[model samples]
Target: MFKKRSLWISILVVTLIIACSTSSSSVPKLRDKHHQPFSSESIWNMPIGADAQYSGAGLGQAKRFSPEINYYIVTQETDPQVPWYFPQNWGVGRCELGGRQLGKIHVRADLIVPDATENKTPNNAAAFLAPDGETLIQLNPLTRCEKGGPVFGHPTPREENIYGMGITGGQGGSGLSSIGGTIRLGELLPSAPPIPHVLKLLVYAHQYLYREPPGYRWPAVRSDAYAYKDDSPLRYGGSNPKLVMGALLAIPPEMREDDLGLQTLPGKKLFHALQDYGGYIVDDTAWDNYAIALESGAETEFELTYGYSFGKNSGPFYEDINQLFRALSIVDNNTPETLGGGGTPRQPLAPPIGN
Candidate 1:
């Protein structure tokens, strides 16, 4: 009787396990409200009509455009005059005004090119402008040739110095790349200064060559390619200033958990500042890349030259930033404060041999 009872119990346990597994399997998968099934190729081949839209309360109005109208520019050198690829005005609504109530904005992008531009191919064409006068940012090609050739008007040569704040590394990597590229208008804008809402915007331009259905195959021009000419008004330094300004505005500030005024209390101030306004998206690969850059010292180099210019930081700020990372658990290993460092050293080192 004892053995029979034990066997029944085991069978019952097995039955329960099977029932639970079946029930769980029968349940449907859950997706985010904005979740869309997309492969790199499918997204690349989608037409302008399929592109996403952006609008919000604070933004003036909702706007829509063909995906082809989105532009990204890549350059070999840093050119202030050249317009960095960023969406200006598509679907931005006015939400808020002061302090932390600045309001929210929405942005979307499609992968396919619209049929309208198929027949009327313009020479030296870069990107299409929205009928409402919104400029589509373009990705410049990086090549060694002069004008009129296949590579004419492409991005700067690989050897040229490149600079940008967010996405410093090339695509599929971290930060921005040495080669220039376009940023979707929605992805460019900073989040509301004080709000905690998380926004995810799609960039339609990068879909050009990667998406399917009408995906461009290998040996085809890179979807990110563009023309580069020294004297051309379209050059990075010579592109439309308004567009450049728009691109700058589109870059979202880093997200922070505390109010901006509270940032002055010290301890992780710089790290929080970076998280709040430096365009690092929390929980995303870009954020990890930024942390890696800081740890590897690339950010230090970047900071020394352009840190202050961007209003981000100065010398020794990395240590403070690292501390912030530690507090947030973004990084491991706490660096002890020491003499010549921000915090006092636990103990003094022995006197120098020469001294």
Candidate 2:
């Protein structure tokens, strides 16, 4: 009867929803140079409402960004010329991050390791999607003396499932993924589309170390508790009370690139994406620089193809990056419930989730 039909309709609708949620790109996402981390519904991929609540303290005004450096992102597929390994188990060495103990883990898939030259950065962090396509494997202090052999690094305390909420990951004092929010390979090229997801940010968590009142927010497991080195000052510790680890820094949806007077194409692209998707505070620079993490070789490709360098203080990236940071307002109300806020989204929901 009519009731039966209605019930069937409801069941059908539910099935469709599940299908949408589980359908992943059939193409091997990681083998390619494209793909962003996390699932369709991931907070990193969601756009905030135009009216999302924010704090009045702008990052630029606070001088929170360190203009000196932009961190690089190392990923599984970064260097195809180099060999890759699928180790049976990941090694742990007093590993700890994002308030979780990397020392304890029960992962089932092979740990994806790269044989490329070990990244020279101190963080030496690298992330790759496990073969299962469900787990995001992170390697901090990833190392390999020989280019084609055994791999070594600590597995994260809490490995994120891309199909799930993806609220947390394996690295950072903030419990964020070294790869999540990192600017993907071609995102900044002149021919590329506007960035489509939240970017990872590193603040100058320096000697003047301070965090938000409660330390961190959802998605972030904790904050930078390392108040200061064993020397110097900072007996009376405190928080910024304005910014936190998990907080999103975004352009109010109502604002346009024109409002910020962004002139460079690169800046305009970054501006639009940042306004729509915002960015996450993933780590601390420990120095005087605010940085956005980028995929390996991303900078090199950009320089060779785009004909500019971030090193130049007068370049478009330097100008726009500084300008955008200054205009950013903390998405203070961003939380599990209000992640995208209440206003209309700038982009469609990310592609449906699935392995």
Model 2 lDDT tens row, 1-355: 9999999999999999878767754443332223665666678788877558876434542233332122223233333323333333223321222232223222223333233333214444666555455666665545444434344454557766656556665445577776667777678888887787888776655422243244677778877555433452422133456566776888776678778777678778878887888888777665545677776567677678767764345655677777887777788777777676656777876765432
Candidate 1 lDDT, 1-355, residue by residue in tens = 9999999999999999999999999875542111111121121111111111211111111122111121223222222222122222112211111213111111122212211232322111122212222222222211112122121122211221111111222222111222122222222123312211111111222211122222212111122222123353322222221111111111112334342223322223233322322111111111111121121122233335433311143333333333333232111111111101112221222111120
lDDT score, candidate 2, position 333: 75
Residue pair clashes in candidate 2: 66-289, 66-290
Candidate closest to the true structure, highest lDDT: 2
Instruction: Provide TM-scores for the models.
Output: 0.20, 0.70
Model 2 — TM-score against the truth?
0.70
Estimate every model's Cα lDDT from 0 to 1: 0.23, 0.60
Q: Identify the runs in model 1 with alpha carbons over 4 angstroms from their true place.
A: 1-272, 275-321, 324-355
Q: Which candidate number would show the highest TM-score if scored against the true structure?
A: 2
